[model samples]
Target: MNERTEYWWVHHDSRIQPAEVGFVGGIPVHFRFLGTAGQVRAESAELIERLPAPPTPVFRPPPAAAASPAVKPQISGSWLWFIGILLLIFVAQCSGPIFDALK
Candidate 1:
């Protein structure tokens, strides 16, 4: 007699050890659990029978397409402005010392 081993499929392509209580698709698709070194597993027939009927796929409205190309924020301009301000502050702070040394 084959022992009924508990198994789990975390997702369509992910798996977890020690089995978890979850289901992926309406139909339990058999997949190999990577945690078990590619050991094949499937949802228990009892669990499949216990699961609520899969919801019928509904027609979802297509996502609205962008009217125009996306405009990326101009981050470089802000960086340049910050550097310019820092340079000005440094020059202002050193002007007195520089003048005194020149004199």
Candidate 2:
């Protein structure tokens, strides 16, 4: 008779944070939920093993001056306005809580 080893990571696929994996006979295996309430199984050997290198630094042009605009400010009223408003709202919210606590 021959006996094989098997392992499983309980609840590997849940809404909870930080998925986990287990090993069986030195071979790790885990469950993954791809869709709604559906579970898919996998093994460490089956999974691709690669160490991703750090991201390369993004090259950005120097700040633009009124005279020589290195990076032209987006002239559209889309992202700039949206992000600007978001920043203002965040600052206002933060200050509101602090002011209320102080008062």
Which has the greatest lDDT? 1
Q: What value does the lDDT take at residue 26 in candidate 1?
A: 46
List, residue by residue over 9-60, the lDDT tens digit for candidate 2: 2333333322223345655444443223533454422433322342233787
Lowest summed-lDDT stretch of 10 residues in model 1?
Answer: 45-54
Candidate lDDT (C-alpha), each: 0.50, 0.47
Which pairs clash in model 2? none
The global Cα lDDT (0 to 1) of model 1 is: 0.50
Clashes of 1: 0
Across 19-91, the per-residue lDDT of candidate 1 in tens digits comes to 2233354444344433344433454322322323423337877767776679999898998999999999999
